[model samples]
Target: MKNIFFILLSLVFTSITYAHEGGHGTPTKNWSFVNNNETIKADFIMKVGDMVYLSNENNEVLTFNYSEFKEQDQNYISEKANFINNLNFTKESHRLKTFDYSILLLLTGILVFVFSLFSWKTKPKKYFVTYNLFSASLIMMGCANTKSSKVLKMAANDIPFLESVFGVFNKVNTRHDDQYFYVESDGIPEHEMMTGITNWQQQVPVDHDYSGNNAWAIPLQPELAENTLSTKENFMKGAIAIAVNGIPIFNPLNNRGEDANVIGELDKWGGHCGRADDYHYHLPPTHLQTKVGEDRPIAFALDGFAVYGETTEELDENLGRFTSDSTYQYHAVKKYPYLIAAMKGKVELNPRTQAPENEIMPQAKTRGVRPDLRPLRGAEIIDFENPEPHQYSLSYTVNSQIHKINYGWDTDGNYNFEFVNPDGTTEKSHYKRN
Candidate 1:
């Protein structure tokens, strides 16, 4: 009986062991190759006992029990699944809801503050504190709302800009890239060689060849000119032009051209100035053209300020031989506010047949002249009084035709000009004459 009982006990113990290992089957041993360039070889070994061992021929061994490996694997899988699920749903809806809430809060705060203004029984000190707190809250809420909108816009616009800017580089840098486009010219394209505009290709003339003066000049249409002269349009154009032109555009009242210099100084101190790269001369010379005919000498002017190249002996001679006391250099002054304001649409140019009353005739001024008015070191001047009385004709050549530009500032300190073709046909720019 004792022997039979012992046999039964041994059989029971064997059955229990078999049951524990049922799903696991045999003592399975497997190896997986994880070919890593960083190491000679990384191999994972698993045994039936739920033991995992990681071996890298070039490094030390890492070992983990079955439970630990299983837990880590499960965690990784869960995280990946969650990420995929989130991507499937639209996250923008939540962002929009948050933005709308911020906007509503801002508006509500403003309304409450405004209504508080009419309250009659409030103590002065208490009222002041309350008003300030309320105003601050309103401002914060408004800032939050603006931030949300800006973020959304950046998200939408950033991708396209990145692709446009970097895609070209990637295609050219990668080999076997036959699908890419190459820009060809006799030499490097003029726009490529020029360093001003961020996206010069967008503004470049598509239908014209850029080999000569025609390439340098842009055409002026009545409607386009009208649009460009509008307060917002003018400001935007000027801002964009300055940004791309790599030059400072200034306001007439502030005729101090020092902003550009200040910006350069800041850059030396590790500060970021404008978005565009720095490229301004302390006193850049004006661009000049040789006389083509007996007609008026064509000169390119911005606002009412004429562009002049550096004074050479010939230029000095042309200025009627002024002595040292009378000799003065012409500076390219940028009008930032006028250009920026025009860009912002706050102002408009009204084109009309009637001339501006504030128009200062070029011929009325003298040669070798400087403005008698003292401008602060950096102030921008739209028009300077010619110290020397001299008559000069002005015209802009665009699309292979020369159109005379009428020069003067409006009463409100805006540019007023017209284009006259060789045939004597004149078209006005859009800036309402005061």
Candidate 2:
């Protein structure tokens, strides 16, 4: 009786040892090879370093250096190696290991029954249930631990900040692949068009497909150009930047090399419909602050720089500056070159219409020109004198000739104007305030 009890105890410990060392089988696939001019089949284990491990039909393990294979076989194994490297082994092994726990619990129950036959001085029934439950709990913990590692790895690759920023724009869809960050839209503004335009008769806003072949994408990482291109002459044409609302912003200067604002072409929103029926902005859309907030970016340049509505710090001539985090950005100004006066980053040069020599008029050399008024089409303020409240005398150049105009409220609140030409002739006009 004593000998039999010792034998059973030794077997129980040995079974538990094997259970921990030998896990459930891993996934295997059939592998074929030619031996002695005969095709041989075996179960493939895995590629370990530079060698492939296999198990023959009789369960004999075999190892072969990858270089020992024929050229054709080497190519086949190389492709399979890539597949095995990227496989999600953590989850797959967890499932198989959990199934092993069931088998372990069953063997533990049998061991308890055999031990009970040898000695029953203690409560055998109570111990049997307790051991089985503990074994099952361990399997659950193993599976949870394995899945958590994969979840954490995926989280590390997510870019949440970019996802949140792009979510703010309407009709804006963004995606990323290996090379570029793509932004797709129909190039339409969310705000009302053709509103508050004095010259809407000449141009009406129209809908454009602006989809498919017109879809725009920017490089995932922006690289600076050797030298920034100036927005002067005919450098900037077509779409230089894209507003968050999906509209394309062109150069502030219209096709004729004239300011769209003074030409009475752009609406109060600083945008107008192009010849392609594409509505776009010539100046910064300052009114966007009411909708998109002053602190947020209003647009993105083709070079992948964010265009903010306003910035407190002084910026370069291009209305661009580096942020606190050293990120380059362009902001809108309240002057002639309102948005960008030049491409602040790298850009592909597109063709632009040449300005005729007659269209490029010279500035006035005889007077002090206002920096703010010089770019206004056919108009420039030379001097201004205010003699009283709401009364002023002004000298301005229009159509390349200087003119003097004096206007104030008469006793009856009627405004009167006296216009003096450069040749010394005067014209008088009056208007009654309603």
Candidate 3:
């Protein structure tokens, strides 16, 4: 009897709360995804990290990954949410808008008082049936008053804070509105590369297209994930973060889940060229501490948290800790999980992907001019030189025998390659960028 009474009582409070929540009569718009053919109607509410909240005609809440929406809908959702969230109310005015619990007490007290009078004027047995109804309604009102408010407070001036972090670097460009900060670059660093790589994959660095729509994005007001997802056996396909010098940073573990740095696949500065000849780092670029400062962040994770070089304090299970300002940050350590153990902030996974091969959405893509290459056994990248702009040469050794590749590109996007074999045989090839 008590359980049944509570259920009825709770519905009354819920209905009342939703009726006054300001979205009651709002019209919903059709929303579709890049992958899904079906569309749903929902009213845009807000963007929290990588997720967006919406409401239906019934005012019931719904949420989806932000990247799941089509390009145009994404713009609308972000813009609409910005306009709504910006209309902040003063504390005094806000307090007035809050639901008044006194009315609930008064209404329920009247119902109970009226029933009490009827019980006293007549046989109490007849009124016993309604006692549960009145008592439960009063209890429900009390519980509703204690429920936590759903209003989420976003971190303000995040764009300015991030600008300060990347301010010292000249190779990267940044811009933002209200939701996200986008960074554009060529995906190559200005520092020395490939000289310290003991294990060679027969690949050399090249400029990759990472501008415009393919630019990297970081959430401005990052939110914590409901459940922390570990980095192990995940985020292997794309970069986990990007260094301040415009270089992408991949997981310390290679796609096969082995430590790429410990396995001798990375150079002294912790970077290497991929199979696509696109350069990125598999470990923390702590060497950048010389430029960005030891106490500062050398990179920013895709989840929007800063990746600091070294810290004296201990880290949590995720290799991060909440700062004195109450914000979270990850540290770069010398051991395993060099930068991040798990994402400290919320992020969206590619909708078409699963685990291991799955990567974060909104990241830039790499375009290669040549076919993907395989590892050359016993090969070591001994030297890399950019004799002039748009021209580069790489030297590697296999069994102490020197081999070289001289490559360059022209204004027409035509690439010319000359390969010199260890036996002094030379071959030439050409490709046109599409």
Candidate 4:
């Protein structure tokens, strides 16, 4: 009975110690002190020897001896002081589970176990037990830590994948609250903008902060709607999704229901400047594959589905399909309604084709016409290519004849465009860089 009791007691103590190391306690909040007819509310900042430091609303610091408060209040202060002291020690204990320290210990134990397995035939029974025990102990300790639970929860939230895909935009500050994933950006693309366009409406991509605190918030876990909305004539919205780099992606079709790519408004990267001076994509950001990876998600749709690279396999009418595990996702394609043919998941739509009176082109507006940039009327895209950085070639068909255009900045920083007609005649236009 005595041995059994000792074992149980040790287990309880071990669990308590592990919990303390993993930050187990409710943080103390600001408290109010009642002294006769007066009440003073302040945060219990710190304790120095017998004095307690407190801060008020106006950032005024006040110090008082332990005995200055009433007996009950004095007891409460003593209890809080003890907790803070214990928290300091607990912080030191948690250092064992820090990323660097934990990785080192885990790797060392794994290497020992691996070596032991290779020499198992000749190794002593005690050596095998010791090596295996060491590795197992590290894993068990890691599992006992709440940090491991946090890591697991983050994985469940799909944070690792987001970090990998959206890391390039970290400078713009990306974060998540309980319900929404917030991203703040200047709405500018790192890639070159508006290279081969003859009529440049808003040539410069301006900065717009859509961090979602007051503007846009993407649902963390999007719920699928019973009735999915199709991407059709009436459903055309300004931006259906946002790229990881913070630039919004509009519908492939313009307000007139014509393909934006065919209309020759987008640059070589399938993006152009908006009326609000915002740079965004109207087609699949295929050029981003070299940066974000071909297999990984290139953009996240408003419906909360990730948009991946195109595949030869056929998808549903919405340009979306499910993963092997039945996780629904959208993919970019070469055809019309490229990024998303329709919203597969649930989303709130305004149903109005025009922006609200007070609207300022939000980063994730569900329904509104993209800024009307009139494409060279009657021109249909034949082909668009980017042979090198800052260089672009566009082919279009007008009046039953094919025409070619090559446009970019020359080595001397001169903006130049060469237009060739089917008759083998060429026209050149030049502009100075601002």
Candidate 5:
């Protein structure tokens, strides 16, 4: 019975020594008076200036002015705020966690005294006493100077790191203001386009001026959203991310609510021409991994989260994981919503637009000189050729017959088009650039 009792006591001590390692407990206190003679129970998260953030019993995060609380609670909040301000959290290395050494020493002395008394009373064997002391020593040493789970949030993204990712492609240029890092390029990739598209629309790829006041903007400091916005029915109107090669990546689904890549609408590089003749990816261009390396980010979502190529870590529903204690980022997968399943960071949606077709503001805009065209049924785009300088031809086959659209432009902004019929007949049209 004595041996059993000692074993149980050691087990309890083992738990006590490590209980404070992972995290500290939060107490629910009456932070503010919601009504007369009634109060709201919330755990104080932290205080940022005058704002005191709290989590209610329902786990809902709430905020309020410190003055709104009772006098005693207000005093506690001020003391907490002052302690938080004095702590050095400027860098991850500086954020430290500590356990009271005095408490540990007190516990150690108590354990030794108890062991001595137990040995004297029970008259245990020499081997048992030695084993008990050794076991206790191991536990004490393990808890000595242990690091806790408290961590600091990452600082704002560095501009140089952003520059290096976009710099590998000569066609893309980058600049930054206080809040946003902007990228500019003519919206056409150096690789092939329009080939391997079985469900081709008659629209051809056009080079857009994705420069000047219309460049893509990525926030310098990303803020986590209170609730993540899912992508299934939202964000269908604008680009969700911008590729390192200066191309925009849209949602995996087309505006018609269909998987564009699986429907044979996308080319070999996972890109297709939109109704406005604008070329963009309906999925992540994972092929760019060869150029940017698999470890580095190949793109940045409009929500300002980095999009990495391949990862072995299990990702969350947002198609992302915390790369560090506080830095979270998205990764490319081989399934639907491959890049970002949702906007993991806070972004301002254009208020005028409604859900499923709403878009993030401060994004680049696109324009087309021609009207929207219907999809050419039974058409398969097999080849895109630049027959000569500034002149190009795109060929497609419908029912085993081939047709081509021969188009080109001049320095004066004048455009010309010749549509060659499969029956050896031809029709021509001309329009000047607006």
Candidate 6:
């Protein structure tokens, strides 16, 4: 009997030893292994026909057959192996599970005690139930408020950043003067819908002109030459470069002597003249010269509008047509020069028939009438066959050390538009201009 008992004990020991053999079958391709003091970790490609067996330090074996296991089982094995490999010397999942179980048990015990106390007396039962219910309700309310607070904070945090990214513009000044000028337009009457002139205020004086001082210089010579006045091209390019590459410089209008006339000319035809927010024409007038002889004919004031009539005779006839309208006439103020440069090649002899360069002119002249420059209204009938109108804005940075510029454009249909930096990088936004 003694011998049989010994044999049975040995057999049990042998079975455990066999089960504890720690290596898996041949360790499939790309397989790796790690043996910590507590667990043996195995990592391997569990492809078709792959079989793996794992053993803990206690000699308990776990076997996995890749072909037989479900997808979830395979994933679990992978995660388990990863956790084992990354385990630190001081922490393990087993310890976490034990702690969690302890906490749950403690909570259960407290709940039981509380239940017993309430059941001990019928009078106290309702009070106890109400107290516990109220406590739980308060906890839930606190948690909900905390979550809502976090959500609100996240929503509010990025608004300012987004506004800065998009860009912003504010009213800089306003003019109260009421003046009527001969604004060129398509054959349509001045009442037609357009975009550029919404809430348009009278032009402002640049500098000392408002101070009741005649010391402001006015331009005596405004003439057309191959390269006579500062071209809008060069001035606009410089302004844009400055805006994009450096800080912005707010240049006040020039009111000194001959500069005033230049300012006036620029106000009429320069600056960002489009209806959209992206178009930019920064050039305005700067200087003036007086004609002395045939080499220099009587120079028009810098602010004077260059009206082109049907013929040379008409041009001569209309030179002083609005002479009495002071607001419409040239003031010889030094204007912002950059916008003037952009106006070059943009103006046409007849705005209705002759298209402005780089613009989509209105078409479909019905009954010999066309639309003029007026504010756009939502749902206004537009001729889709014709090139849609557009608007543009200019932005630039100017610093002593660097300059940068970005020009933006918006199509009238709100189909396509882009903000283009001088460096050729572009950001696009979509909008529909009704």
Q: What number of clashing residue pairs does each candidate have, in the order they appear? A: 48, 0, 0, 0, 0, 53
Candidate 3 segments whose C-alpha is farther than 4 A from its true place: 1-157
Ranking by TM-score: 3, 5, 4, 2, 1, 6
| lDDT against the true structure, each candidate | 0.29, 0.57, 0.77, 0.64, 0.78, 0.27
- Say which candidate scores most in lDDT: 5
Off by over 4 Å in 1: 1-77, 80-84, 120-124, 152-434
lDDT (Cα, 0-100) at 134 in candidate 4: 57
Lowest lDDT 10-mer window, candidate 5? Answer: 88-97
Estimate, for each residue in 202-298, the C-alpha lDDT of model 6 and write its tens digit.
Answer: 1111111111121111112222221112222122111111111011111122212122224332222233222222122232121111112122111
* Per-model TM-score versus the true fold: 0.20, 0.43, 0.67, 0.47, 0.65, 0.17
Cα-based lDDT at residue 313, candidate 6: 22
Worst 10 residues of 2 by lDDT: 360-369
| Candidate 6 to truth, TM | 0.17
Model 2 clash count equals: 0
Model 3: weakest 10-residue lDDT segment is 148-157
For model 2 the local lDDT of residue 73 reads: 68
The superposed Cα distance between candidate 1 and the true structure at residue 166, in angstroms, equals 13
lDDT by residue for model 1 over 281-315, one digit each (tens)?
A: 22221221221111211122222212232333322
lDDT of 3 by residue, 1-434 (tens): 66766676676666467435464575559998999799988888776545677777876667788899999999998887677555532433443444456356546756775776678657575455556466556645554543433333434426666787677788788888677788888777888788877778777777877778888888777777644555775788898888877789998888898889888999878889998889999889888889878888888888888889878786665778877664678998887777788787878999887777678877789999889788888888888898997788889888899989999888777889999998889999998888
Cα shift from native, residue 46, model 2 (Å): 67
Give the per-residue lDDT digits (tens) of candidate 5, residues 1-434.
56865764775576466544533345457754433466777787766435577777666667777677878888888887677555533323432323454346446746765776667656667645554555565455435434342233545777999999899999999999999999999788878788999987788877777988999998998877745666776888889899988899999988877888888999999999888778999878888888988888888988888888868886665778877646788998886767788788888999998888888887798887577788889999989998765677999999989999999777776668899999889998876657
Q: Which has the higher TM-score value, candidate number 1 or candidate number 6? A: 1
Name the TM-score of candidate 2: 0.43
Q: After superposition, how far is residue 195 of candidate 6 from its true place, in Å?
A: 23
RMSD of 3: 16.0
Residues 1-434 of candidate 4: C-alpha lDDT, one tens digit per residue: 45644554565456447645423234334444554555577667666445677766665567776666777777878888799777765764565456565566557667877987986889787667665665565554444553533421111237656666788655456777676676667565676666665444423443455655544455677666544554543345567777877777777766656677775677778887666556788887877788877888888877677888898765665777777744677888776667677677777665444432111133453211224344465565556666765566767666778887776655554656688889999998776533
Give the range of the ten consecutive residues with the poorest summed lDDT in model 1.
217-226
Arranged by lDDT with the best first, the candidates are 5, 3, 4, 2, 1, 6
Model 6 Cα shift for residue 243 (angstroms)? 26
